[model samples]
Target chain A: MKKESQFTPFVEKTHFWGSIFSVLAIIVLVSVPVSIMFYLNVRPEISDVLKGFWGVALIFWPTALIEICFYTPMMGAGATYLSFVSGNIANLKLPCALNAKNIVKPKKGTDEEEVVNTIAVATSAIVCTVVIAAGVLLLSPILPKITAEGSVFGPAFNQVIPALFGALLGGYLVQYWKLSILPIAAATLIVILAPTIGTGALIPICVILSIVGALLMYNNGLLTGGVKPENPLKGLVKKDK
Target chain B: MDFKESKFMYLIAFIVIAFVIGQSLFFLIRAYNHGKKIGLSAKKMKDAITASALFTIAPAVSILATVVVLASSLGTVLPWIRLTVVGNLQYEVTAAQNAMEAFAGSGKAVAFGQDITDPTVFSAVAWVMTLGVILSLVLCPLLLKKIQKKVGKVKLDSGSDNKFGDIITAATFIGLISAFVGTSLAGKASTIEENGVKQATGMGAGVMSLAVLLTSIILVVILQTLCKKFKWDKFEPFVMPISMFAGMGMAMLVYAVLPESISMLEWRPAV
Candidate 1:
């Protein structure tokens, strides 16, 4: 009984449209070089072809390739694994008394299972935040060149990003989800207030805030609220056994 | 210096090894428990174990192999970029610049796409990129199948179409914007050096790199979360684009880390 509404992202089949745009974008990008190469009509040398194969063939060795993707994807991937694990625990499934109406109420002939919609935007933000923070740190030694004079217009865009993340964060923040507001609010405040702590401090603070925010949300019973009955894995297992 | 001897290479080595070994152990145990929990067939369970292990280890294999080949070969090929017929131990330049020279000397700096019309050293680099994508596509399915066996019933693809396209789209936008921003900042930073001016700044290529790194982690954690949120489990579609974005982001970072040879950010006393 799954409708098409549940099959897409954001509003409508936006993923479909977005993917179309992405393909078009790549096509445009890839075409420019290809067109020039065609017009110039230069064939690749045998030795060059051999070299191309060699580099690609080398990637099969895990002992060497993981770091190339940057450190964030690794951690971010690990976080997904943890959340999956967390989802499996019995204690995690205990129905909250606070949301009894939402939890227990069911329409006639409707599936009685409680399914919480796992918001993609919230999780996407979480992973991106960690990875981007780490990348910034790795690049810290060489940034002065670009940032020094870059700061002129920076006076404007500096506010743009945080303001955006803040609004995005608000859209996902739920009452039963956890006191994530505390951490999100703390992070925003720190960025705005404690400019002295600088770039390096931002990561640790954000991490702490996210953790605290999650904790607060959990304590406030927002975790229960965040769970929409539509979550595929929801209520499939009984914990009291 | 050989890539093996470089700090970056060493770091990559350590991580690949750790991830392959570590994730395998954790998920293998998890697979076993999951099998026990769901009353799945022993054969299915065994398959899941193998699948999970492959999932953990395969990418490391592909990445390592790809990098090593590129590095080792690039080492040899780069000399050809500036060939010298050293007559009797005396370093003498026979040929000044060849096709590769033409490419670099063309003077139009559109880095996103380097000129391939003239087959040169840079073209060879481009070839490596072309082949890398091919290798990944060819080898990934085999690896994914092996991993599926290890995971028991778990699949990277939930077999439903969710917001994957949107996620990738957003990621690309994120990467492109970040790169452009870094480029401008780099320009302005040079301007600061020119104007004999300097000041502390809150963001720049450094922040962008940080943002990209953050974005990658966010994508990884969230990609699957996205699947769960949107109830779509097809990861390969998103991973490919994400990997591309990550690569672009990394390249920008490499550019950002260049030494201040231009004295772009150095403070100077007013005359």
Candidate 2:
């Protein structure tokens, strides 16, 4: 039997509330369209809804599943739940969590790390929400100027992903130059060849590649300061006093 | 009934947005209180909050650009709700487009940016967008514990001597960032016609994107170095936001200085 004390009280509470909020958010999200139909007196055919849904689900569902698996380990329970619910994990939440974690240098898997990630994710969610709300009200006047021909905003907005990622990558490269080489080289080559694979799909593949590269480097004595020492503890585990 | 930008739609959007805000606050307070109990310094907590909020503003504005693009066809409220909640611009736009086409009923291809006159079409897009991502939300509550436990095991097995945990974490993030860096550097350009407007997408926006990216990298590197040198611990949080806006400003400057052939291509609505 598994021990009941494996998880701390804080983690247990986080799970309970996270599950509840996740379920509630889904119910509320679904209710919006249903409410719209009720108010407008128009019923969309079930077949149509399924058709549209299956098409997107074919793509998004698998990608989202991959994201959850990849990201959950880094994000603690609370951040995982809130981030999935609030969305924009890759572009916004993940970066925010990473920045906080790096700056604070919390030990992995500790309550402090969990709290830091949760706080970062939650704060990002709130700010994004408020900003969007404000933007909606204020965007009407500037909409044309933004979308108009030769609009600087259009080009600038288009470059956001690159600009954002570049800064992030700059920091990481400086810190983890060895780990950075393989993944950057491989991903750059792959994307140049097939730009259509999409970032979501590429994330998992690149992550696996990076792990393999790190393992290879560590095995080859490349990571051990040029000394490939033998396994010092080989066969020594059975010495029970 | 007027479905697009109706008072009713705005009200619905407001309610949903309010719920989202509440959820964020709920987690924020819980995490904040937990930090206190866990011996996190007050400065660390404040930095987390302040930095995250500051970092969010630029990206949120970019998201606002997505909302504006979608609003002309879907209406302000729907896009507003979609972007604010569990949907991204790419997924929402694609899902809504797929739904619109599926609901066409006449076998006619329905492109985005066409005014959604029929409430049925609007409802279909909404349903598809909502339900397509339902699994993500469902899976989190169901599988998060298992995933966390598995990852925790990896951490434990790594022990004190092995740097496996650190290596894996750094590698994972490096891999993710590298992919984006590759894409940005390659500048894959493509054109799509939406609502008879030809939009040049991808880094194909010319050297402009690449320039912005490099500028951001340089700015962040400089800022981080300066912060470390000057012991500007108080100003550390501003590094990302400063680089982001500077990168954006770089884009505008690049566009203005360079000609259309070398900079971003001039695209316009189709006649």
Candidate 3:
């Protein structure tokens, strides 16, 4: 009989809790508005709720599905449960986890990487929740300064997303130069030429394109050696171990 | 029971927030224990926690801005609760507007805040926003394990183990980055009238955003180059936020030089 890896039971335990907590999350989230309506003795008309939901769901539902399918593999098990529940995957949790994984240099498809990702994402969720709670508590005083028009911080705040993506892309370009070309070109053309595709749609299309592009490149013998040969910049940075 | 900010509403917000925090702590502790049991060093684990916590601060502040903008219409409690959970500014704002438009039965614009005095409209907005994102939450609990298992199978079947997995992960990341970069770079030029002055707006605004993007990239590259040369491994975690702030600072500087017709700042409409 083959002895099982020690990490197998840990991974199983994580999934068990992941499922339970995710269900708990769904229940708590759904119950909020339901409980509110009951307490207030007011119920929104089904027609109104459906119509409103349709307007947003028409775009978001597909995007949400794509996001889950796309992000789950990258985020791993425990991180996936916490991230999906906490939200802000792209702008917050994903980046945090990716950076942590990069710093740790854990082997991909390994238990160590999964543990690193979960820790990073969980920390991000905790920090984000605490910060938002504090902000809400101090909303009366801090809101005006943060939201003030023409404040010097205004431009800085507006540029956060662009800056974030830029820094992340810089690291990616250095690490994945060979695999980067087709997706970048495709995405650029879509944005420039199509102009009709929504931002939500653009992400999944580009993701699919990139996956196909990389697979083709890999099969063609253009890519090899598990991120070592491609990342010239990695040579410049000395790893401690 | 006012539709706007109320004490009872704050109570609801607190309850939801408690759940959010509890869930986060539960996951954090579980991951920490698993990491320790599996031979990950305590130093590395602590570093990940510190780095992730520090990285979250700036983005959390940006999210705070969304909560403030939504608060003007949806009340402090609702926006606070929504943004804290599985909601973002783009979705919440659009859902609320759509709900109001549906209630009005006209395609014409419907303002929120004081105008949303009706309890029915408020409930409708709440329901729509909640339901719009429910699919992701529902699918996650049901499908995540299957999805991850499939990915694991693909890695095993491919015979490359880490190579194929690395390529896929890198490709996914590059694909996402390309979309955002291309959007920021490819914004169309448009003329807009502001304060009785007609001026170029859209493309110029895009240019300013591009400048910020470039600045961040350059800063990261420079810092990374230095980190490489000097082997400042300890400074590695700070690179993301430092580059981000550098880019944001450059944005303000660039905005100062541009004409007032081009508002570098994003302005939410007042209720």
Candidate 4:
């Protein structure tokens, strides 16, 4: 008999906790409206609720389902549950976890990687919750500044995601240059040509492209037996020059 | 019945937000304990926590901007609740918009940005927004274990030459990042009507985005190189956060300095 991996029990326990939190979160979230219906005595028409829901559901439901499949493996079980419930997986949690993994250089499927991912995700969630809570408590003063036309924070806020990704790509692109080029080029071309297929949809397509490219390269022995490169920009300037 | 920011809604928001924080802390403590049991270093875990917390500040503020946008029409407490938990700006706004339109029902078609005056309309919007994201909550418990199992099978290499699992994970991440880059670079700037206001979008917006992208890339590369050369390991965790803020600062500069005809980095209304 194959001995159980030491991490199996841990993973199982994580799944149990993840499921419990997710279900409880759903109940907690749903109770708001349920309570509203009773306490306020403001019952929206069942048809109206369905009518409002269907269109948004048509878009979000499919995307949410797809997001789970894509993000689950990348984020470990604990992180996956928290992120799905708390949201902001793409822009914040996943990248934060990935960055920590990259910095720590954790091996795939290792306990260390799982711990790092969960810690990164949990910390991010805590910070975001606190910050937004502060924003709400101070909304009266901050609202006008943020919402004002031509406010300094306006342009900066708009570009936050792209900016964060830009920084992230600088390191990843260098580290995985061999595997990155084709996907980046193909994704860029598709985005340019089609333009309407938003980034959310493009992720899975690009993942396939990168995976195929990496496999082809690996089979051809292009990716193996090579040491990861040092920083290519290290020689750009001398401190004493 | 001003339910949008009513005392009851605020109380509900407080509970939900508190629950979210509690959930996060629960995971944080569990992961920390697990890390220790598995012989992971305390310093490493602490660094991850610190870096993640620092990294969250700017993006969290950006989310606050979304809250402000929705608050204009939907009310503060609702937007606050939605954004803090399982709701994003684009989806929530669209869901609210759809609900409002359904409520109006050919009378005059109320849009998302306009103040939602009807209590029933507001209630419907809240329900729609909440339900839109509930699918993941339901599906994750059912499917996550299976999905993780499938992925684990690939990753659990038994002394084989094939390391495809790790490569596949890296490829997925690279592909996702590449798509983001592509989106930032693609698109044409064109005029569009928003709330009866004709505004240019796409092209100039893309340019500004590109500028911020470049700023971030250059700053991060420089920071990394400097860290490596000087052995400033202590500053390494702060690298991403610094680059993020610097990139955002570049956005403001680009907006301020560029000629109006070319700089389409205008203040976009969230709705």
The candidate that achieves the highest DockQ relative to the unseen native structure = 2
- By lDDT, the better pick of 2 and 3 is 2
**What's the ranking of the predictions by DockQ, best on top?**
2, 3, 4, 1
TM-score of 4: 0.90
For residues B121-201, could you state the per-residue lDDT of candidate 3 as single tens digits? 677788888998888888987888788877776565554445666778899888887777766666443332222344332
- Model 4 lDDT at residue B184: 70
Tens digit per residue, CA lDDT, model 2, A1-241: 9677556788888999999999998998899888988988888889888988888989999999899899898788999899988888898899889887867778788888889999999999999999888878887668658745478666677677877887787677666779988998898788767756678888898889998897677666676787764432332243322
**TM-score, candidate 3, chain B alone:** 0.84
Could you tell me the lDDT of residue B30 within candidate 4?
90
User: In what order do the candidates fall by lDDT, top score first?
Assistant: 2, 4, 3, 1
Q: How do the residues A1-241 of candidate 4 rate in per-residue lDDT, one tens digit apiece?
A: 9877534677889999999999999998898778767666788888888988998889889888889999998988999999998888888888899878866666668777888999999999989988988988877576658745478777788788778888888767656778889988998789667755756688889989998888777766677775443222233233225
**lDDT string, candidate 1, A113-224, tens digits:** 1111111111222222222223233532333332233433222222222222221222222221233334434543553344333222343344444544443443344554
* DockQ values of all predictions: 0.05, 0.65, 0.46, 0.42
What fraction of native interface contacts is shared by candidate 2? 0.77
Cα misplacement distance, residue A199 of candidate 2 (Å): 0.9
Model 4 ranges with Cα > 4 A deviation:
A1-7, A147-149, A225-241, B106-109, B157-159, B162-165, B188-205, B265-271
Please provide, for model 4 over B116-215, each residue's C-alpha lDDT reduced to its tens digit, 9 standing for 90 to 100. 7767677777888888889999998999999988777645432143355566677889888888877676643334333545544323236688888888
Query: Which lDDT values do the candidates have, in the order given?
Result: 0.28, 0.80, 0.76, 0.79
**Worst lDDT 10-window in candidate 2 chain A:** A232-241
The number of residue pairs in model 1 that clash at the backbone is 65
What lDDT does model 2 reach?
0.80
In model 1, what is the error at residue A88, expressed in angstroms? 33
> What DockQ number belongs to candidate 4?
0.42
